[model samples]
Target chain A: MQARFSVDSGDFTKAGSASSAIKRMLKQLGVKPAVVKRVVVALFEAEVNVIAHSYGGFIQCDISPEKVNLLVQDTGPGIPDLDLAMTEGWSTATDAVREMGYGAGMGLPNMKKNADSLQISTAAGKHTEIRMSFSLKEGEDGVS
Target chain B: MAFHRTLKVRENLCKSCTHCMKRCPTGAIRIDRGHAQVEEAKCIDCGQCMQACPHHAIAVEQNLFEELFYFEKRVAIIPAVFFAQFDDQYSESQICQALYDIGFTHVYPAELGIDITRLYCVKGADCKPIISNFCPSVVRLIQTRYPSLVPHIGLKTTPSHVTALFARLELEDKGVGIFYVTPCPGKIAEFHRLAEAGSAFNGVLNMDTVYNQVSTSLAKNKRKFAKEDGAMSFPVMTGSAATWALSNGELAGRKGRSLAIDEIHHVMEFLEFLEENEDESNIDFLELKACAEGCVGGILTARNRFLASERLRYWATSLPSELPEPLVQRIMKQKDAMMDKMTTPIHEVSAIALDDDIGVALYKMEKVRKITDALPGIDCGLCGSPTCSALAEDIAQGQASIRQCTVLRLKDPKEVNTLARIWGEKVTGEKGEGK
Candidate 1:
């Protein structure tokens, strides 16, 4: 099964919509709760990252009996330093964005902690595409 | 497996107007054979249907009034909200006296149990943002819909159950009957579930039933009770216990970052968000209730919810801040036993899952998505189902047929007929049509 959703740039109010929809689908499929939580948390962080930092983006989810794969592609001025962005508590968010209680610099790190495998493709002046996969088999990643 | 529920629809009184079907939060009700039918597994017994019915067709099952005579000593464990049901003219002692006149040998406020649990019961260091299990309907909703969050629910038993246990222990040798006077059908269902697990409760009496009897008794002996003293013989409760059934009542003095959410729809929305983002929210505790203003807004309640809540809050101010020493010592005597019962864990009841097997559930979900896309987007509720997606889900589950969609039948009869033949006419009244 596959589902796709678009995330508008700077739309803080609707950042978690895509994650919420995917969570509902995963729950209906009788996926394990811990796996669902991991998927949702990672997707939510990636979704918010696009809305807060990029121009605009879309999320695509592919689900199988054994695992779920996610692709988040955004049009933007990509990261100048990937390693620095992965560090906790390091952010470049504006003061106005910080007032909304977001941009805590936990997005990429939280996503990396939740997804079983994560890969990023980006340049200083190009768009960024993120790929993440979550294994659904019991006892994998301590899900059981 | 079918679970016990208290709400029922009278076939004779149903108008098939689709009022209750639309109001159900879980989409549990569906019109069948020109009458409303409830799917037992899907129902959380929130009483939304009872409140939405125009013809008064929905009724709550309760123990008969005469059932109180089964024991020599009948005790009524009543919530403070029950006293708020009457007009301000009726004093608490008058109502207590009226309960005796109506055959109750003793009257005890249900909040006394809250005091006991507060002092003696040791809470477990379970999941974060512990959900309060005070409201039975909210607990049922979580069990049926959000099964993953089951670990987050507090394991402590509710105040009424604690009070019933206390009452039984106090009168252990008296052969007493402990009856909970409930302001909602959910409590009756809860009592039944607890009774099956060897609880101390004997039966449940609807608040409206007992209210009518007390009103009659009070009216008949108005002059006789008017001259009596205003003092209450029953044990008094702490101020917080008096308002414990109201909205925000449970979170009044609790420590840590807590939130109290009332009304089923709002609670459902918040739970959906919390399920996904549990660790990020930083919430320490949650007090969720199904009714708008908590028990004061129960379907079985008599007075206006706001007025009743005000009365309870006002009454709370006149009471002591702490339980009397005698009451505290009584609770201390049974501390070990109460802790054993209170700490019992609540298991998940994943009733809403499409299938127990993940692979099969995934296939069914894909089918449901395809069917939903083909159907009209408008939630007309003309096909006996609450929404278009619900019908799609039903069809995928082999519980309904595509031919039941009146809109599709009207738009393209040939296409709908062909789809019905492919999907199988499993629905009643549509059989033998596609053959």
Candidate 2:
């Protein structure tokens, strides 16, 4: 089954709530703790990308006995320079956002670091989509 | 050891995103039980977790202000920046009295310690990038990540330490009480360390706590205090002294050869600079600040208009720009004095254990990476972990399980389930999400 959440931008006070929610949901299942932590980091990085650097976006997730998939779609200004944005220390957030400790330019790189077989498709004004896959443990049963 | 609640985890507000783990310098938070919790020893109390908790659920403990009234004198030694919170209404002089009227026996301005900082760092070393040793958080980072450069840190303890030292020495006979008004959680952590088993200061009062008390008084009465000359004994030589309250203030204050940097992102360059000290003498001190603009604009302060911190830069610059005691010459004598103090018993955080068994940790980290890689990259905090890595860590630690994800997991009985269904099919399910 798939679930969706609407994350808002400019509301730094509520920035990572969506990511936190997803982490907890996966934890209740018989999933490995290590994989859960990585997905949470990647997802939170994307959420920050939308709020700090773009318009608010939505986080779409699909879960099953096999693996979990997360998709983040945003209406914000897509990365002007993907390669640069993908770089470790490059960021466009204003000094104000940086003060909040939200823009270290580590968001996309961190997401890519944590996600498996990551795929991202972003256009300047159209839309940006990021898809990631996480495999399940072998011995674990699909009780859900 | 894990707790039913090591730290507060507001599950309803979580979105299960992974941003927190990415930002977590120490990887302390883990997702489970529909929320994230602090991994005690793992949390350095840098308050990055509190800073990143968008839902306001994750917060440092509140203060015992009203409760303090029952004990004794309530002297709030507010950081200098706290003076700026009241706009032009509360300048240095006026507010000292305001604090007096509002249940505090006296208000010890922490900026007073800036004089100690100024007196201590002046003279001696010229053009040798001296990192400011005033922020305990910055100091802790040194201990945790840059142990080799421990020798380079200014021998003087941070301003807060100096303040604590001064408070005890100066107030021992005064018979009055003292409290530290904190703007950052890092300071609270410092206070925790300082005030632990063998301690100094009495208590730490956070900004929110003091703000509540001050706001009430300001709203009720507008009486300003006396305009005493140098109401603050801080030897303000140049506007640069004031700049210390803001970012890059140390750069402006240095009278000798030095470089100034203010950005956490510049850690790599800093490491390289430390490695290759080319212009040896021309760079006595490196006034490196973690925040981009500087201390006046820290993670804990109120969010102002765009670049509002610059206002402090201009205002401080307009005040004056002369250190009472010049650097270069003074630092020479000060260095000898400090050298003895440098050897003083102080904890050194191990920085960049480059040769440590990273492979072991990496192998451990990879397991987490694998699980998180499959989840939504959206750091919504729905999973209660700060990020996906945190959730995976929880699972690895056995604190949480993956079946908790109702959003991604299949319903009750399902032969049609994705992960199990695929895993049951052998080759197709070998590496994918299994049913």
Candidate 3:
């Protein structure tokens, strides 16, 4: 099964909509609670990152019995340094983003920590594409 | 899968008006065969249906008043809100005396257990944004709808149960029948659930039932008893415990950044947000209740919620903060046992999942989505279901059919009939009537 949701840039009000919808769908599919939580946490972070940093983006989710794959792509003023962006407290978020409680610099770190496998491709002045996979099987991907 | 429920529908009294069906937070009620039916698995027993019914068709199940005679010692565990049900003219001691007159050998305030829970169970929670399990309905709601958040629910048992445990220990070796006088059906359902797994109390009584009996006794013996006419001296709780059933009651003196959310729908919306951003939110404690003004707003409550809450708050101001020394000593006697009992985890109820198997659930979900899209967006509720999406879900589960949608039937009668033949009419009113 598959689903797609678009995220408008700086639309803090609707940042978590996609993640919430996907979470509900996964729950209906009887996915383990821990796995669903992981998916929601990772997807929410990625979704927020798109809204807070990029121009706009869309999230695509593909679900199977054993795993879920998510692709988040955005028109971005992309990360100049991947290592720096991956750090826990480093951020390029504007003061406006910080005021809204979104620019904690923990978004990427959270997504990396929650998703079983993550791959990101981005460059300065180019679009960013994030690919994350979560294993749904019991006792795999630390879900049990 | 069988569970205890305190609310039931009287078929004779139902008007099939769909009021209860629309008010149910869990969408557990559906009109069937010209009467409202409750899907037990989906019901959290929040009493919204009971409050919504115009004909008083919904009834709260309670132990008979005579059931107190089963034991030689009858103890009534009364919530503080019960006293607020009466006018200011009725003193606490007068009410206590009235309880004695109504066959209760002893009367104890339910919030006395709050002190016990605080001292033993409220500290050292590992789950960030700990959800309070004080409201049995909220706990059951989380268990049914937000199963993933079950681990976040604090392990503290409700104050009433804790108080009952103390009562049991104090009255050991006696033929004691401890009854919880509850302001809501959720508490009764909680007692029943606990009783199924072994409980400290013997039975449950609705607050309205006790209130009526006490009112009658008080009215009959008006001006007959003195202000302090040998009323049983129960332990007085701290001011916090006195107002603990009101909104924001649990967060009064708690540490950390805590939030108190009341009313079931508001609680559900917050829980949905919290579930999606669990790791990001820094909340330390949550006090969620199904009733708007907490226990005072319970469907079974007698007085207006605002008046009762004001009365309770006024009463709390005069109370002392500390439990009396001897009362603390009595609680200390069973400290080890009470603490052990309070630590049991609440398990999740996977009642809302579409299917036990992932593949089949996915297929059913897809079908529900398609059917939902095909149906009219306006949720008329004329088809007995609460919403179009609910009907679609029912159809996917083989419990309903597309022919039940009155709008679709009105729009394309021939197509609807053909679909009904394929789907096999499941609803009672969907039979061939040549519409």
Candidate 4:
């Protein structure tokens, strides 16, 4: 099954709805609590990143018997250095976002930590897309 | 031993009014067979239900009064909120003396524990949005509901544990039993968790129970303590620490931004805000209290919270700005003996899952969603569950049937009967007896 949700830029109130909806879907699909938690955390971080940095984005998810796949694509000022952004404590978030506790430079890092496979494709001053997959099987811990 | 909650329901007092089911922050309460039943796995023991219940059915477990006599040396660890419970006629010393007069070998003020916790904890050291550990209900909420945020909780043992352990060392007697006078069921639950870990406290004494026991003489009682009256010993913790019982006291003197939130529902909302926003709030310290106005608003307390807050504010002016030398020296000396880890590991409190198997849980979720779409949106709680979604989930799980929904039955009898027959057939493999 597949589901898609639109993400609004700078809409902190609606920032988590997409991730939360996906989380509910995954849990309803009978995903393990541990697996659901990881997916939710990863997707939530990805959602916030798009909201904080991008003009807007959409979350596309595909759930199968073996795994759940997620694609978060955004049109905004894309990352100049993906490696630097992935590094912990490295952030280009504005002071306003920082005050809200969003720009700890840990969002992408957290996504990487919880996702079984994380792939990011971006071009400077254009767009960024985060592609991640989480395994559904029990006892296989998400990639740290 | 695994963590077990102490909050209980007296079957006779429960009217099955669903008052508690609506109030519970975790959705842990449900009406089963004309009685309010608490699903222990999801209950955080916040005592909201206890206060909400008009019948006074909810109660927490505690050591019997007769059991206090067994301890060779008994000590009463009193909370600072206990001082505000009295009129101006009674002094803190007088309450300490009255507790002694009431057969307690000694009275140790919880202020001492507050001081110890404050002194040792490094506020906003490494973890941002650091949560206070003093409020046991808030701690339990984080543990059960927000397991991901467990690392953010302050790692300082509560003052009760510190004082109890410190008293054991000072008395040099292993048989010295420490009894806590708590304001809410959550604290009692904390003691139960501590007991599993072999804590210094031997038992818990309810504040209302002890207040009634000493209310008569606490104001009138007098005792002289000019060095020679050695048995009339009580720890003197006169400082800003006395204000620790009040809301936002933990955030006092902190350099960074912070919030002091009370009431269980607000705490839940704030935590959700934190979680949904990816923990980005600038608040450094979150002094989250389950009660309305911190400890003073606890369900078991006697006075009004605002009145208590006023009294506490007036009392705070009289306290010393710094800790007394003796307490300072004692805390410095025994710092090593204090608990290094304070946050209690918690399990998921939500019972939203339909089955252990992911495939089965998915099937159940679909069934529940379909059932929920048909039911009335108004969450009247006539079906025993707190909300319509909850009732739908229950029906999908087979713990309940669609017939339990009085609204649907009355509003659309034909649809109700048709749906009930379908579900009944699914369950029994035959035609169902229509309601």
Summarize candidate 1's per-residue lDDT along B1-435 as a digit string, tens digits.
Answer: 346889999999999999999999999999878899999888888899999999999999988889999889999999999999987888887888899999999788999888887798467536898999889888888888898788889888888888888888777737799899999999988877877688788888999999999999999988777533755778778999989999999888888999999999999999998888777778888999999999999999999999999999998998899988987888788776666776546667777779988889888888888889889979898888899999999889877778778899899888986777666553335635421
Winner by lDDT between candidate 4 and candidate 2: 4
lDDT of 4 by residue, B129-185 (tens): 878888888887877666556667776677777778778777776568788999888
* Local distance difference test values of all predictions, in order: 0.87, 0.58, 0.87, 0.78
DockQ of each: 0.75, 0.02, 0.78, 0.30
Candidate 4: the clashing residue pairs are A30-B358, A100-B280, A101-B280
lDDT of 1 at A30: 80
Tell me candidate 2's fraction of native contacts, as a decimal between 0 and 1. Answer: 0.00
Tens digit of lDDT per residue, candidate 3, span A1-144?
Answer: 889999999899997899999988988888888888888889989998999999998999998878899999998878889999999999999999999887888889999998999999999999999999998777788475
CAPRI grade of model 2: incorrect
TM-score of structure candidate 3 = 0.94
Error of 3 at B378 (Å): 0.7
Name the runs in model 2 displaced over 4 angstroms. A1-144, B1-26, B48-54, B67-74, B120-129, B146-151, B197-199, B223-239, B255-284, B290-292, B303-435
lDDT of 4 at B118: 63
Ranking by DockQ: 3, 1, 4, 2
Candidate 3 regions exceeding 4 Å error are: A76-84, A124-126, B118-124, B228-232, B336-339, B418-435
lDDT of 2 by residue, A29-48 (tens): 43444566677778878887
The TM-score obtained for chain B of candidate 2 when compared with the true chain B: 0.69
Docking level for model 4: acceptable
